[model samples]
Target: MAVEPLPEPLRPAGSGPAWRLRYLSTSWNGHPTVASGTITLPAGTPPAGGWQLVSFGPGFNGTPDRCAASQAGTPPFIRPLSEALLRAGYAVAVTDYEGIGTPGESSVVHGPAEAYAMVDIVRAARRLAPVSRRWAAAGYSLGGHAALWTGSLADGYAPSLRHVGTIAIAPTTQWGLQFAAAGNPAAPVNPAVPYQGRTLPVTHPGGFRAADWFTPAGLDLVDLAGHVCIEQMAAALTGLTMADVFTDPSAAMGEFTALFDPHEVPVRRYPRPVRLAHGTADQLPAVLTEITAGQLAAAGTDVIYTPVSGADHFTVAAAIAPQVVQWLEELFRRP
Candidate 1:
């Protein structure tokens, strides 16, 4: 593990005392890789067990190397939450995930890879500051999925760390819903669907060919995705439908399922407490999150599921930040 002061320009505005980190972690395909992140410590002195930690996962920013949170300033969606946690007297560790600021393409929504990066960042953060071994995982959108995966994987993957819980705000849960819509000729496409369309083949382990999946027009957008962040990609692909973005919308199901299914959240019961919150009006849909929370509960996870009546995707994290911080406080206070 390596640590360095985050260059002033690179640190998120108002992040207070922060450090940039590069640490050893595994990629989605199981190859050992170096991952990077930022650790932001509160202004005051530590408490009895040292400052508690929150391994924060930011939502989808983009897939390219330039879009990393530690490289690019933190995105608005998750910045409030991280800052809020810091203000609440905890150190926040935010991973850039599998390849955001590093060499290869980022895994995007690959849960385990992101989870490994998330859990390991806490380990790395501990070495940098006076921190407690007890930590919680939290994230928004795509990150929310990674946070939940961290809950399930943390105990086994990093036995030395005591993972107290997880908080997921509008996490992406059902890939089938999104992919099925993409496969439908008449379905309207969201930026994320096409975004994933461009990424899945490239990130897949078997070295899947992009030509087999995208039409010529889609291929051009795929090329664009490699260079731009989510906002730019979204603008470029705006108004396109599924038919415009895929070669044969129905064709990639086998590979798509193979690539994403195993990475879905609640892959097994979460032994730690979990708090899931989603906006009823989110583009990702609250129904899917509800279903996922149900499965986790049935599987013996100690989960509290809450749906914000009218909030949408972009606002859910800020809307629930106070509640989440309180929950984390209570969680860390426990035996």
Candidate 2:
């Protein structure tokens, strides 16, 4: 399929930071695609040595325009995260993903499309700047799932781009289990409500309203379900047993069982090192990380699992930033 032309570049609205923001049009499965965001290079830094690439996946269904890196809002999320990486001597690329900024709804379903967009964004970043192809992937919640999925298939997606390592902080690993636990027998419920601390907006284009799908008490129930689902999915996908959710012997033995099982994916199969962090008291719980660690370890991949005793999913980042940064630094140092 012929790729679409790039969008016109939007000038930086302010001089908060010296960075370049551009739009690159690329193709995924023959569809015209546009990825827009800013790339931050360290001040007085020359691009002689190949720069390390950090491709970030943002939480929930956030648009790249909202990232701190784009200078869209006061205290951008991407800006702080990217600055941390830049101070650590890494070049960063933040993708708006398929639907966040340009057009269409984000491919929330964990499939080839989201994975393709993420991989393409990294390539697009390299083309737009003087950066080495060596890369590390990181994300939170939904973005975490994308990072792991991309890291799992990095070799085939972009052979030129080195897959240094990946980090998934409080990732949403199992959609099917999450939905089922959220009291939806037929579909996955919205995973954004708990993080937002209120019922999700009913105006969102996605089907189903917050009130229609979940009661007041069901809000907390959905959070619990999300926690259970992530653990179960990791367990089922990785051939580990984190819980008894899938206890039916016949259901457990089926071939396609693990596809929907969330736990059967074995995320560690990707040809690179991996790190996972979760808080024990997190609204999402730390068992998900434990299950993830078990599965990755079983695959013989270099894995680092941190169980923060008092932190919740939202607060784990601050508590574990030092470890996360060190792990990423080690990955980029590899030849």
Candidate 3:
């Protein structure tokens, strides 16, 4: 990786405050590689101790190189919530994961890839800035998953740094519903996965059968995600029900099962304070937090789960921005 001063395209602001685009040296899926990101420092002077760091993980946009948030010319505020962090005298570092903008297959929503991106960006930012040891993470949607993963892996990946807490808004947390969608459906379109693997039947959502949950149209969009950005993918797949797509509804990809496991979910074993903002009406299902928070609290993690009665998944990001910022303010000030 080319180590040097930040570049022009990455400059978060015109001149006053500081921001930079830089390439970092890190490992992707275990192999050392180069990744990219933007780091922005607040416009004002730091506190007596120093500026606290908030490494941000932006939600999934797409897998293509241009889809990387930093490369997409993402505005200074990745989220309105980030403006709050900057105003509060915190420095923000946003990573592009390893492949999204670099030389590799976009790992989709892989946990380890997002985690490494967040952790390594922090390490990279510290090299060029006067950052304090105290830090926390905040992300929404796919990025929310990354925030939790960052906190979970911080101890092992970047133990030298002190992590205050994590804030995840509408994160992909409902693993039980997500994992069991095809296996257990209201109606069975031959839902069972037998010992013998074969394409059983192609069907539709006549009743509530599972086999047709993913429509062919929907599956096509999944394939599109490999090469396009998030907005385009969502627009293509949003209204098409799962039943329309595949012979086996939702395709119960045997490959994705490991990620949906409790152990694979974020915040399960991470020992740190966590704040989750979920909307009851979210497309992903609010019940995911019920399972995650219950277990984390039981395991001695200080977890706060807030459900917005009628908020949708995307809208919930703006709804909880202030509270999440407040939470960070309180935590970073703690002894």
TM-score of each: 0.94, 0.67, 0.79
lDDT of 2 by residue, 1-335 (tens): 11232222322122122333445443334466665545544444546656777777656533223332243321232334445666776666655555455544333433444556667767766666577778888876666776777777778867887778889877776544443444323323233423221212211234333334344444444344333322332232343221212222233223222333543234545678888888788766567667777877888788788787797766666666677789987887787
Candidate 2 residues lying further than 4 Å off, grouped into runs, are 1-32, 61-80, 184-268
Identify the runs in model 1 with alpha carbons over 4 angstroms from their true place. Answer: 9-15, 193-199, 253-255
- Which has the greatest TM-score? 1
Between prediction 2 and prediction 3, the one with superior lDDT is 3
Off by over 4 Å in 3: 1-28, 73-78, 182-223, 250-255, 258-263, 266-269
lDDT of 3 by residue, 147-206 (tens): 887778788877898888888888876554665664443323221122001111211113
lDDT of 1 by residue, 1-335 (tens): 87789887765445567898899888877788899988988877789888889998888878787888888877677667767887888888889888788887766777788899999899888888889999999988888989988998999999998999999999888877666656776566566655665557657645666677777887788778778887887888767866787667776655576678777775557788999999988888899899899988888888899998798998888889899989998888778
Better of 1 and 3 by TM-score: 1
Relative to the true structure, how large is the alpha-carbon lDDT of every model? 0.82, 0.55, 0.65
- Per-model RMSD to reference: 1.9, 9.8, 7.2
List the candidate numbers ranked by TM-score, top first: 1, 3, 2
